[model samples]
Target chain A: AQSVAQPEDQVNVAEGNPLTVKCTYSVSGNPYLFWYVQYPNRGLQFLLKYITGDNLVKGSYGFEAEFNKSQTSFHLKKPSALVSDSALYFCAVRDEYGDSSYKLIFGSGTRLLVRP
Target chain B: SAVISQKPSRDICQRGTSLTIQCQVDSQVTMMFWYRQQPGQSLTLIATANQGSEATYESGFVIDKFPISRPNLTFSTLTVSNMSPEDSSIYLCSGTGHYFDNEQFFGPGTRLTVL
Candidate 1:
């Protein structure tokens, strides 16, 4: 069975400082990782994905994630956090093995609070 | 990215009644999925809507309780039958493109409150 884990329940950061949201996965095959952001009462917005190549994948809003194959981690990062960046973040993974359904296994979300 | 939209942004329904939420994608998609997000919880896949066939439900979800319909590639519906307070949650519709284009876009979820 494949699963995703987000260690942090919430992360608070001062505006203009860097921020990181940790994510790890357990999959049998090569993992297709993704990051999504959800605002209050809004749908999830696709931030970025790592399918193949490029361990460091850049996403929307100056956000980037480093995919560590050995460590099985894909952590979301930002150089300078903004108040507008405060939202809920979810890390999801899809198994690229036998199943082609493209069903996503999501992690427990991490709430990001960027204080002004 | 595909633009997905869901009807009835939010609704308050009486217990024992059923609510049918509609999902429409701006363009044709290869796959459409329905998810449930309870208060302060992560999203859970409810079922996968298959065009012209029966929906494939995930564990803990049933056809009678949550019947899905995908008449076409661009439209689908999820009906929550015999609703209860526990069924109160945000139902999200998602769509993904072809094999190479695998980014799954989501609808602005339908918030259901059972009373």
Candidate 2:
């Protein structure tokens, strides 16, 4: 079974400071990872994905995630945080060898709070 | 990227009633999926709506409780039958492109509150 784990229930950071939201995964075959952000009363917006690429992948809104194969982790990062960047972050994984390859198993979302 | 839209953004319904949520994609997609998110929880896959065949539901979900229909490649519907408080959640629909595209575009979810 393919699964994703987000250890933090909430992450607090100050404006202009760097932030990191942790994510880990367990999959059988090569994993296709994804990051999504959901604002209050809004749908999820795609941030980035790590399909078969360099460990470091850049995404929208000045966000990036490093796919650490050895660690089985894909942590979302930002050089500088903004108050507006505070939102619910979700980490998802898809296993190419799984029974339903197109299905995405999501982690319990982490709420980010950026203080101004 | 594909643009997906869902009808009845938010609805408050009484118990024993059924609600049907419609998902429409701007372009034809190879696969469509339905997901549910309870209050303060992660998203869970409900089923995969096949183009011409019956939907493939996940382990805990069954067709009787949540019937799905996908008559074509660009549109699909999911109906929540015999609604209850436990069924109150945000239902989301997503669509993915051809084989090579692994990214799935999601629709603004439909919020349901069963009384």
Q: Which candidate ranks first by lDDT, i.e. highest?
A: 1
Off by over 4 Å in 1: none
Q: What TM-scores do the predictions have?
A: 0.98, 0.97
- Candidate 1 per-residue C-alpha lDDT over A11-86 given as tens digits, one digit per residue, 9 for 90 to 100: 9999999999999999999999999999999999999999999999999999999999999999999999999999
lDDT of 2 by residue, A1-116 (tens): 78899999999999999999999999999999999999987888999999996999999999999999999999999999999999999999999788654888899999999999
DockQ of 2: 0.76
Name model 2 segments beyond 4 Å from true.
none
DockQ of each: 0.85, 0.76
| Model 1 lDDT per residue over B1-115, tens place | 6888999999999999999999999889889999999755799999999999999999999999999999999999999999999999999999996843679999999999999
Whole-model lDDT, model 2: 0.94
Candidate lDDT values, in order: 0.95, 0.94
DockQ, candidate no. 1: 0.85
